[model samples]
Target: MLLPQVLPALVVGVAASLMFLGISFLSEEFQVVLWDDLPDALGIGRYSSLWMITMLTATGIAVGLVVWKAPGHSGPDPASEGLGGAPLAPGLVPSLLLASALGLAGGVSLGPENPIIAANIALAYWLGRKAQPSLPGAAWVALASAATIGALFGTPVAAALVLSEALSSQPGRGSLWDRIFAPLVAAGAGALTTQLLAEPSFDIGLPPLSDPGWGDLLAALVIAPAAAVFGLAACYLFPYVHTAFRRLRHPMLMLPLGGLVLGLLGALGGHLTLFKGLEETKELAASVGGWSSGELAKLAVVKLLALLVAASCGFRGGRIFPAVFIGAAFGLLAQALVPEVHPAVAVSSAVLGVLLATTRQGWISLFIGAALAASPSMLALLCVASLPAWLIVTGRPQLELDHEGKALH
Candidate 1:
């Protein structure tokens, strides 16, 4: 009975993954040119503080022009949207893509998730309607969102967990598994497609936790909530920073100004604190033994600040990836401060806390924390740690903003 829907959903999932990978590849190429090839050709150090400032500033101006002149103003400020907000009209996809690509290439401390998902949703909704006039619009939304989430994390489990939270909140028919069946299929297809092509990975190569103990539990309980508090700090600051940028009243001015500020932050934090933070998180983890507690703390703080400014000042991107980086840095800092704590325990717990605060999505937070630590043994500890952390962030202002510019709860 469901084969028809299932087949189309699978196809949409594959298409969505392809779209994400294609955009990422192009953006990375541009990033290399701006941050690598051009710098080498000009005899300028790519990571030189001055060059960082110049490139970021230039990137800001360029992105601002796109947002100002491109169709649909790049489809609303990202601060006002969540991971699966209303899909944009097809007309706005190009501008959104360009803006996102520019931001990604320009060292914006945000990820491709938001704009890419939005673009995919818009495209899926438009095309799906054309092909299957009888299918509900919500069906297309579910397929596209699931597919994107799967592709983003390189696993269908992420999509399933996220959608479970979302579905439980709404009125639905049939069993939970029954309702989620199609989306899961789509998610599986998307995850498999990305896995085959991009080989995306979340593990940061932290040592595995082969054994669990009371101390590990204690570490998780403390570190997770602490990291959540750190992330909540950003949530509290979101609206104020967003309002400050809005004062500029135009993207061209707002974005460039934001860029200049980000450049200063990059200069302060170095290249490690720049960009979306996925690869950088690995870099930090690989060299975790060498960094002092204070240096790791500074790296986390500066990256959070950069995320705040970039997301606030009209950059089209997502917060999740950067938040992951912040969590990892904090986790590493925790390990540095208390050498007895297993690196896996500290990192997973801290990531759980930060993600809990920033995303307000328990499943996603827990999943990401475990994935990064590459330690299944830490899951039970993370689950318990998440309890207090959830309380700390619950009912508090979220990182996302409403149309009135107030923080969403």
Candidate 2:
């Protein structure tokens, strides 16, 4: 019994690791070319403004071409699909991988989570169906989702938190773990594998909150809602952006146009504001002491708009990484203005707000806020902050697209 469950998870871990290998290698090479090798080869100084623009513009064009009339078209607009969706047809796998590779490496402001999830689902499903023809389709989805998420976030907890609702709703469960036991097996293996490979550290480097005061709670209440409002502004603008781009009616045109605009935004915001927020967040955190509140504000706005543009223009990936970056920048801005507030409270509250506003996952948002800020002392404060933030954005539309790839008004 245990062997059957554990063996599949081991397979998932190995497969997911293999996929990450390709993504890391290609993306690293792309970065080195734009920032290092290509600059010297072409006689231009490294990190030149021109190289930056060219890299992004070229990324947009290349991504657009791969996604245009390609075999998979990148397996559907990721904006239309949330973190999880039905698996893809086998034929779509080739194009999905290509699109995913481009999006991950080509400097798009999205992460590898969504496409990776889809790919994992297809692979796991194929294996499960062939071996265990008696199993339900939902099980395959759950298992694949768990394995991939575990691989990406370097923890099974992220997958478990994100999937709690789905698991809880299942009809015949001995316990939540019983239903998710196999996925957890896959998750543990996946997390272990990723950790061995990447050694990722998500600590956003904010000063730890040692003691929380009422002022911290109060600040959280204010900042969290403000962050949510900013997120709401983007939500309102998303449909308009998509509609405007749809006017072009062709990936060849719309995507490249978005790339140009994104490049301009990057020029406006500088290098710190580009790409998925992982490494950049660390850099921003380290430099918060030097930046003006105005600069921080610009970073936040640019990232939010960049996220909208990237998602609207058919870039395929997840928004959480970018949202985390946006929240961190906004939080840094808050701290700059009000030095009295603990960095932990300010940054966590800000993260909680934007993530709640965008994903509407209250628990996950709170967890992320606590995790990224590395402030266990401020967990209660983050919870307090998350309440009002969740209330403010509860009924509003989310940062996702509908079946027809149109944003909800």
Provide the clashing-pair count of each candidate structure.
0, 0
lDDT of 1: 0.92
The runs of at least 3 residues in candidate 1 whose Cα sits more than 4 Å from the true structure, single-residue gaps closed, are: none
Clashing pairs in 1: none
Error of 2 at 25 (Å): 3.2
Model 2 regions more than 4 Å off: 1-3, 405-409
Over 72-144, each residue of candidate 1 has an lDDT whose tens digit, in order, gives 8899878999998787999999999999999999999999998988998999899999999888898899999
- Highest TM-score: give the candidate number: 1
> What TM-score fits each model?
0.99, 0.95
The whole-model C-alpha lDDT of candidate 2 against the native structure comes to 0.80
lDDT of 2 by residue, 1-409 (tens): 4456777667776676657656767877777766678779989855556766777788888888988978867777666788778878867877877776776665678777777788888877877888877777777777888888787878888778877766666678477767778788777778888888777778978788788888988999999999999988888787788878888988889888888887788888888777887788889988767889999999999999998998888877788888988998898899899988777787788988999887777767877888887767778888778788888998887788797756653
How close to the true structure is residue 306 of candidate 1, measured as C-alpha lDDT?
97
